[model samples]
Target: MFERFNLSEETLKALRKKGYRKPTPVQEKAVPLLLEGRDLVGQAQTGTGKTAAFGLPAVELVDPSRGEVQVLVLVPTRELAIQVAKEVGELGRERGVKVLALYGGKPVAGQVELLRRLRPQVVVGTPGRIRDLLERGVLDLSKVRFFVLDEADRMLDMGFIDDIEFIHSKTPPRKQTALFSATLPEEIRPVIKRFLRPDHGEVRIEPEKPTAEKVSQTVYRVREEELFDTFLRKLEETPFRKAIVFTQTKVEADELARRLRRAGFRAEAIHGDHSQTRRERVLRDFRRGRIDLLVATDVAARGLDISGVDAVFNYKLPLDAESYVHRIGRTGRAGREGVALSFSSDREDDRLQRVRKVAGDAFRFVNLSDRPVESGGRRPSSGGRFKKTFGGRKGKGTFGRRRSFGNPSGGG
Candidate 1:
C-alpha cells in the first residue's frame, strides 16, 4: 500500500515491521504533502491514525548526526506528549534519532540529565513545560527545523495560545511548521496566519462519528444546592446505568466522585491531575464495570475512543456550548442509543437556555428531574461478558493491553 505513495525505503521498512500496511485517510493525504516540505494544517477527527500522518515525515527529515533539537512537537497534555514522542522515537531508532517527551508532574532533573548526554534530536512536550525548559535555558530551539502543534484547537480550547507564542519565539523562523486539529477556532486561525508561510497546505480527513449516534439527550431541573444530591438519587432507582459524569473543573470532578463513592456508588475520578499510570488504571476499571461511575473533567474525556458508555451526565454546565456536545458524545456510541442528561439547577437556568439555543435541532431533550424519585434505585447491570475491543478506558478500568510506545515521543 505504501509503494503507491512513494515513501522512502527506510520508512517503508519501519511501517512494515509495525504491520502498518495501508495508511489511514489522514495519513494518506498528509504524508505526501508533509514529506514534500509543504507546511500544512491537517484536520481530522481523533483516532484516525493522526500521529503517523505527521510522525513519519518528521522522523525522515531529522538529522541524527547533529544531536541538537531538530523537531519540536507541542501537545496539550503530558500523556499526549509522551504518546507522540514514543511514536516518533520508534520509527527513528535505526537512524539514531532520539526523542524526549518533557512535561510537568514528572521529574525535571532526569529530563535535564538526559538532554545533557543524548540531547535528543526531537523534543515533544506540553506548552507549559516546553516554555519552562526554554526559559530555564535547558532546551535549545535555535537549530530546530521541524515544529508541529498537535491538537492545536484543543490547545486553544485550553487557553494555551500565549504559551504557544512563547515557544514559537524560541524557534528559528526558517523552521517548517505543521498543525493538526479537529476543528478550527478563531484563535487557531491566527497561528496559521502569522506563523505558517503563505500557501501552506490544508488536509482535512473526516472520520466517522459513531459515538454521536448512541447518545440520547435529556435535561433535568433541580435546586442549586440539591443538584448533586438529586443526581445521586436518580441513579439509585435507574437500571443498567454505568455512567461517566462530566464536570467542568478538576475540583468538581474530585468532589462529585467523592460524593458518589460516599453514596455507595462504585466510582473513581480521572483527570489531568492523575499520572498517566493512574489514568490508565481508572480507564481499565471503568471499562471492566468494576466501577459504576467515572467522574472526569473535559481533559479526561477527550481522545477516549471507547464505546458502550451507558450514560453521560453533565453534572455541571459545560464551560462552552461545543464542549457540551463533546461531553455527551462519550455515550450513545457504536450505533447504540445512550442517555445524556444535563442538570439545570435554578442558578444555571440561563446556562441551560444557552445550551438549548446552541443545541437547537441537534438532539431532543426530555425533562426527567420532575418525575418523583423511586424510593430506592435499582442496581445497574454489568457490561456483560467482556468483548475483546479497544480494551479499557485509559484512566478508568481497562480490559486488555494498553497500547505501548517504547519511544520517548510516544508518537504512535
Candidate 2:
C-alpha cells in the first residue's frame, strides 16, 4: 500500500529501513490525501499507526535545503511529543530534515536556544510550549506549510484549546492542517471549524469500533475488599508476558505499585507527579521487558504505544466509558491476541453499567477462581473463604480493619 502513495525516494528508503511493508487502514486512506497537500481530519483509534499515517506525508513534503520550520505537530503530552519526534525524525533522516520535540517540563531556554540553532523543519510539541515559544519570539511559524494535531481529543480533554488556537494563529493561513482524533466529541467541531479550511478532506476509519476486536475482554466480580488479593491471584495463575494495571488516581497508582513490588513482581508506577526523566525511564524499562508490570493513571498512559503487552488489569474502574476503552487498549496490539480483565465490585455497579452501555457487550464476565491456574496451587475462587479472610460485610468491606474503602491512607 505504501508503494501506491507518491512518497519521495528519501521517505520510501526510510520506510523500507523501518520495515513498514504495508500501510495501516488509516495510513492507506490519509497518506495519499495528505501527500497531495490536502488538509485532513482523521478519525481513528490509538495504536492504529496514526502517527505514521500523517508523519510520512509531512516528511515527504519537507524542503530539506531550507532550514525553516515547515511542519508543526501538536501533541497533548511531552512523552507523545518525544515519541512522535522520534518516529518522524527516523523517517526524515535521509533527507537531513531536522526534527525537534518541544514541551514544558524541560527548560524554556534550552528549547529556545535549539530552535535558534537548528531552525528545525519539523517541530512536534505540546500546545502550551509551542504557544510560549511563539510569544517569546523564539519559534517561527511563518514558513510552516503543514500543521498536525495528533490526539486532538486528548488536547481538548486537557483544556489546551486556547493554546492550540493561539499557536494555530501564528502559522501561515495557506498551510495544510490535519486533526487526528480517536473519538471526535461535539466540542471539537468549533475548533476544527476555526483551524481547518471548510473543504478539508475527511478520513474515518472504523470510528464505531471503540475497542480492538482481537482483544478478549473479561470482568472479574471481585468484592472491593478482595480487589488486591484477587488481582494477585490472577497474576499468579495467568500467563502474562507483560501487563499494565490502571488506577484512577496517582495515589492509587503509587500504592498499587508498592503492593505489587511487595508481592515480588517487577512493577513501577507513573503519574502526573513523576518527573519527565523518571517517566521516560519507567516507560523505557517497561518496553524493554526490564519491568514486568506498569501501574499508571489514565493521563500518564495516554498515547502509550508498547507492543507485546499480553494483559491489562484494571486495579480500579475508570471514571468514564472512553477512559475504560483507552486503558484496555494498552494491550492487544499489532495483530496479536490479548486479554483485558476489569474488576467490577458492587460499589462500581453504576460505572460498570455505563461501560456496558457504551462498550456494548464487549466483555465477558468471569470469576477469577474459575480460571485454570497456570501453577500447581488451587485457585482462590471461594467467596466464603474470601469473606472469612477479609472479615468484613459482603457488600461493603475495606482492605484494612481500621480503615474504610474510601480512605486514601489505606490505599485500597
Candidate 3:
C-alpha cells in the first residue's frame, strides 16, 4: 500500500509488521518531500499521526553507524518532549537507535551524563534545556543534519523565538529543517523566513469533522460575581466525576481548587509554579479517575495529551482565540463525543464570538438558563477513561492545529 510513497525496504517491512497498513494523509503527503532533504512547513490539525509522518523521515535519514547527534527536535513542554521521545524510541527500536529526552525539572546531571556517554543519534528536548546544553558546549550542532521545531507556534508563543534563532545560527546553514504547527500566526512567519532554506515546501492536512454528538454542550451567561455559584450548580446537574477547569492565572488555579475542595469537591490545582514531581502526582491521580476535578492554568494544560476528560470548563477564557479551541479540545476525542462548557460574562462576550467564528460547523451553543421543566439531563458515559482514536490509531491526540500557506514565502 505504501509502495507509491517509495519507503525503503527496511521501513516498509517494519510498517507492515507493525500493522501500519496505510499512511494517514499527513504521512502520504509529507514523507516524500521531507525524504528529499527539502525544508518543509507542515500545517495540519491534531490527531493526524504527525509524529510518525515527521519521525519516520528522521529515522530513515539518521546514520546509526555514526555515534554523533544527527537530528534534533525542539518542543515547548516537558510533557511533549517525553511524548515525542517515546515515539522516536519506538520507531527506531529495531535499529538499536539511541534517542534521549532532555528537559527542565529533571536532574540536569543525569541528562548531561547520558549525553556524554551515548551521544545519541536523535535528541528530543524543550528549548530551555537544549539552549542550556548548547551554552555549556555539551551539545554540538556542527554535525547536525536533521532539525525539526515541532509545535512551532507554541514555541513562538512561549517567547522562544530568539532562543530558536540562536540555536539555528549554531547549525550548518545547509541542514535539513522541518517545522510543524497547527496554526501559523502572523508573528511566526518571521521565524520561518529567517531560518529555513530557499526551496521550502508546504503541506496542509485539513481538520477532520468534530464529533460532539455524544456530548451535549452548554454555555452559561452568568453575572461576573455569580461564576462560582453557577459552576457548582452545573457540577450537581452533570454526572461527570472528573473534569478540567481552565483559569487565567496561577493564583486563580490555586484559589479555585481551594474553594472547590472547601465546598466538599475533591479537587487539585496544577500550574508551572509547582514542582515537576507535584504536577506528576496530581496528573496521575486524575488519570486514575481518583481526583474529581483538576484546576489548571493555561501553561499547565497546554499540550496535555490526556484522554477521557469527561468535560472541560472554560472557567475563564484565554486571551488568545486559538487557546479557546485548545481548551475545548481536551474532552472530545476518538469517535466518542465529549462535553465542552464555557463561562462567559457580558464583558467576555467578544472572545466567545471569536471562538464561534473559527469553530465553524463543529460547535453549537445553548443558553443554560433556558432549560425546560422536564429537562433531559446528561451523564458521563460508562466507557473507559481512555478512548482509542478513529481507525483504532493510537497516540494521535493533538492539542492544536495549523492552517497551510498555498504560496509560501521564505523572506525574513
Candidate 4:
C-alpha cells in the first residue's frame, strides 16, 4: 500500500488528492522493485490499478530539470494512449513533468509541433504512430530511461508486433523495461526473450473470472426473431441505472442504438470510426448520467474505466469466450455487484456452451423467451432447454488454462 512506501511529499499529496487510500496488490509488489531499477513482467487483469503500479515509480524517476524524454509508454490503441497519458500526467503534475500522448488518426503535424515546443518529459503512444514519428526524426528516444509496454497481449492481437519491435530497437538497451498483460500466450516468448532483461522481476496475479463472482450471470434462450423483444422486456423489468450493450460489429451497434432511441430509451453508439472528439463527448455524457445506455463494439470499448455501470447486456454473443469475459467485466467493478444478461439463440448454442465452460458455476441457465415459461404455466423442464445441448456432464469448470512464467526473460 502507499502507506507503507516512502514516496516524496509531492507525489503523496497528488495521490491523496485523487483519493487513493491504499495501493492495489500489483502496486504493492511492483513499486519497490520498479523503484530499485529492476525490469518487470507483470501479469494482471484490467481495472487492477496497473497504471499507478508503474506510473508512480515512473514519475519518481523523472528529472524535470533534465528537460528531455525520460519515460516512454507504448500502448495498443489511441484510446489507451490517451487514458494512460492522462493518468501519468496527473500523478506527475506536482513535479512539473510534461506528459504527451501520440497516436494515429490525429494530425501528425500537430504532434510534431507539440514535440518541438514542449519537449515532454514522458511520452505515451501507439506503436504505429510512434514509429512514424521516429522515422520522421521528429520525436527523440535517445535519452529515454524507462520504457513500458502496456497491454502487450492486445498489441500482438492487433498485429502491432513488428512496429513494437521497431520502436524498442530504437531505445538504448540499458533502459528499464516492463511488459504488462491480462494474459501471456506462448507466442510472446520470442519478444520477451529479445527485450526484457535476464533477471527482470516477475509479479503475476492469478487472473480472476469476476463475471461469475461479482456479477449475476444469466443466459436466456430465445429464437432469433424473439431476441429483441426478450432484451426489451429484460430492460423494462430491471432497474438498471446504467448499462452497456455489446454488439458484434459497428453497424450492428449503431443500428441497435438507433432502435433503442426510437423506442424512447436514452442510448448512444460508440465505435472505431467515431471521431475522437465525439467519442470523448459520448463517454463524458455516459459518465455524467446524461446517457443511460451505451451500445459499443468490442474494439471500441477497450481501455474504458467507467463507474456506476449497473448491468451489461450481450445483445450478440462474442466470437470468442475470452471476449465474453472482457465484455461482462465492464460492470461488476470496484466492489459493486452487477448483472449480466445474455440473449442466445439455438444457432448460438455452441458459443454459449463455450462461455459456460469457461464461466463455470458463475453462469445460471434460464429460458425466459418462452411465453408459458414466463407466465409460470409451463414447467421449467418443458421450456427450451439450453442444458440438453450439452448432452453429457459438465467439464468440472476447467476452461482455458492459465500459464505461469516464473521468469520468462530467462533465455536458454
Candidate 5:
C-alpha cells in the first residue's frame, strides 16, 4: 500500500482518490529513494506509471508556503509538459501546492504573467521554453530543489542536449536530480554524469515483451497501388470503437485524413505543422469520440497517452522496429485488447522482417493482396478464421504456428 511509503496523509489521500491502488514496478523502486532525497535514474516505458513515481516525492518535498518554484520538470514535447504538470498538480492539490506548465506554441507573455502572479511551487515545461524563459529572466530556478529530466533519450534525439545543459546549469547543483527514459544509450551517459550525482540510484524495469501483450499484431502484404484500397476494405471488414492510422510524413497524414473524411469517416490529422491550438483541439475531439479516426505522424504522436484506442493502422510502415512497437502500443493499453494492422509492400519486406524479429510470436503475417475486394464488405464472423486471428484463438495458416496473441494461458 502507499501508506508503507510513509508519505504524508494528504499525498496518500490524493493517491487513493485518484484510484491508484498498488505501486507499479518503477514506482515501487524509485519512490522510496526519491523520498530519501537521493539522486536517481529510472528506466521505464510511458505507461509504467513513472509520473507518479517521481511526482509523489516531488509533492511531498516541496514547501507550498514558499510561494516559489521548488520543482522543475523538463520534457521533450509540449503535450508531455501539459500532462506532467496536470498530474503533478493533482498530486500536490491536497497540500495547496501550485503547479504551472510552460511550453512553446502558446504565448510566452501569458506564461510570464502566470509565473509572477501564481508563484507556483512546481513548474513543468519543454527544454526550449524553459531556456527561453530563463534567458528572459522570468523563470527562477535558483530555488528549485528538485530537477527532473523525463524522456531524456527523446530530448537528445530532438537535439535538445545544449538547451538541457543550459537549463541544468541554471539550477543549483545541490538539487535532487532524477532522469527517466525507456532506454539508456551511450549518448545519454555523459548527460547523466553531468546532471546527476556520482552515486545516483538506478531503477530498470524490463518489459515482458517489446510491445504490449494484449495487442494482436498483423502484417498484410499488398501492392503499393492497392495499399489504400486494402486499408479501406479492412476498415469495412473490422469493427473498432476508435482507431489511429499512422503515416510516415505529415503530408501523408493530412492527405490520408482528408481521403478518409471524403470516404464518409470521421477523421482528423495531427502533426507538428499544425498550430498548437489546432493540435490540441484535434486531440480533444479524438478523446471525446468526436473523431473516430486520427491520422498522425511518428513525431507528432510521440509521448501521447490516449485511452480506449481499440485499433491502430500503419498506413505506411515505420523504418525501424522501435517505431513499429511504439505505433502498435497506441492500442492495447491498460490491458484492454486491441488490434494492430500494417500494410507492407514488396520492397518493404526487409523492414517487416526486422519488426518480426523484435515482436516474435506476437506478430502474425497474412497476404491480403490476393483477396478480392467486395463492395461494403461484411464484418468477419466471430468464429471465422479472420476473427479468430485477432481473438487470441488459433486459426489455419500462420496463426496456427503462433500461440494465442493475447491469451495469458498461452505461454510465450
Candidate 6:
C-alpha cells in the first residue's frame, strides 16, 4: 500500500482519489529512492506509471511556501508538456503546490505573464521554451530542488541535446535528478554520464514482450491499389469504440483522414503542419469521444497518454521496428485488450522481416483477399476461410502448423 511508503497525507489522499490502490513495479522501486532525495535513472514503458513514480516524490519534496519553482521537468513534445503538468498539478493540488506548463507555439508574452503571476512551484516545459524563458530573465531554476528528464531518448531524437545541456546549466548543480526512458540506446550513454551523479540509483523494468501482451497483432498482405479497400473492409468487420490510424507522412495522414470522413467515419488528422491550438482542440475532441478516429504521424502522436483506444492501424508500415512497436503500443493500454493491424505489400517484405525479428511469435499474418465477402454486406463472416501464417524460420514460412483464423486470440 502507498501508506507503507510513508507518503504525506495529501499525497496518499490524491492517490486514493485517483483510484490507485497497488503500486506498479516502477513506482514501488523508484518512489522510495526518490523520497530519499537520491538521483536516479529509470527505464520503463509508456503506460507503466512513470509519471506517478517520479511526480509523487517530487511533490513531497517541494516547499510550497518558497513561492518559487522547486521542480523542473523537461519533455520532448508540447503534448507531453501539457500532460505532465496536469498530472503533477493534480498530485500537488491539496498541498497548495502550484504547477505551470510552458511550451512553444503559444504566445510567449502570455506565458511570461503567467510566470510572474502564478509563480508556480513546479514547471513542466519543452526545452526550447524553457531556454527562451531563461534567456528572457523570467524562469528561475537556481532554486529548483528536483530535476527530471522524461522520455530522454525522444528528446535526443528531436535533437534537443544542446538545449538540454543549456537548460541544465541554468539549474543548481547539487539538485536531485531523475532520467526516464523506455529503451536506453547507446547514444544515451553519454547523457547518463554527463547529467546524473556518480552514485545515482538505477531502476529497470523489463517486459516479457516488446509490445503489450494484450494486443493482438495481424499483418495483411495486399496489393498497393487494393490497400485502402482492404482497410475499409477490415475496419467495418472489426468492433471498436475508438481507433487511431498511423501514416508515415503528413500528406498521407491528411488525405487518409479526409477519405475516412468522406466514407462517413468521424476522423481527424494531426501532424506537425497543424498549429498548436488546432492540435489541442483535435485531441480534446478525441478524448471526449466526439472524434472516433485519429490519423496521426509518429512525431505528432509521441508521448500521447490517451486510454480506451480499441485499435491501432498502420496504414503503411513504419520504416523501423522501434516505430512499429511505439505505434502499436498506443493500444492495449490500461490492461485492456486491443487490436493492431498493419498493411504491407510484397515489395515491403524486407521491412516486414525486420518487424518480425522484434515482434517474435506475436506476429500473425493473414491474407484477407482470399476470404470471400458476405452477400449484401461489407463485413466478412468469422467463419470465412482464410490462409494464416506465423513467423518461423527464414525458409520454413510457418511457425507451427496452419491454424484456423476463426478463433484468433484477443479477438483479432
- Per-model TM-score on C-alpha atoms: 0.68, 0.67, 0.74, 0.66, 0.69, 0.68
Candidate 3 backbone collisions, by pair: 182-401, 182-402, 183-401, 183-402
Better of 4 and 5 by TM-score: 5
Error of 4 at 157 (Å): 3.1
Q: List candidate 2 stretches off by more than 4 Å.
A: 207-216, 220-300, 305-326, 331-339, 343-363, 366-412
Write down the RMSD of candidate 2 (Cα, Å): 9.8
Worst 10 residues of 2 by lDDT: 386-395
Candidate 4 per-residue lDDT over residues 1-412, each given as its tens digit:
5856788888888899899999889999899999999999998777789999999998999998877889999997788898999999999998888899999988999999999898899999999899999999888899989999998876775678999989888898789999998767787878788889999999987545655668988777777798897777676655565789999877899999998887778899988667667888999998887888899977668677788787899996777677788888888887777888887874566676667657866776765443322213333353333332221222222211111112323221
- Regions of candidate 3 where Cα sits further than 4 Å from its true position: 93-97, 105-110, 156-163, 197-199, 222-229, 248-266, 271-275, 288-290, 297-302, 316-326, 332-337, 347-364, 368-412
Candidate 1 TM-score versus the reference: 0.68
lDDT of 6 by residue, 172-226 (tens): 9899999999778789999999989999999998644545378988888676678
Which candidate, 3 or 6, would have the higher lDDT against the true structure?
6
lDDT score at residue 191, model 4, on the 0-100 scale: 75
The candidate that wins on TM-score is 3
lDDT of 1 by residue, 123-194 (tens): 999898888888889889999899999988777766678899989998998978999987776767889898
In model 5, what is the error at residue 376, expressed in angstroms? Answer: 42
What TM-score does candidate 2 reach? Answer: 0.67
Q: After superposition, how far is residue 184 of candidate 2 from its true place, in Å?
A: 1.8
Selected candidate, larger lDDT, 1 vs 6? 6
lDDT of 3 by residue, 150-265 (tens): 98976775667878888888888778999998777798788888868768999987654334575545555556677788766566555454579999888899999998888777
Q: Count the backbone clashes (under 3 Å) in each candidate.
A: 38, 0, 4, 0, 0, 0
**Where's the lowest-lDDT run of ten residues in candidate 5?**
395-404
Deviating ranges (above 4 Å) for candidate 6: 105-107, 207-216, 220-299, 305-311, 315-326, 329-338, 343-363, 366-412
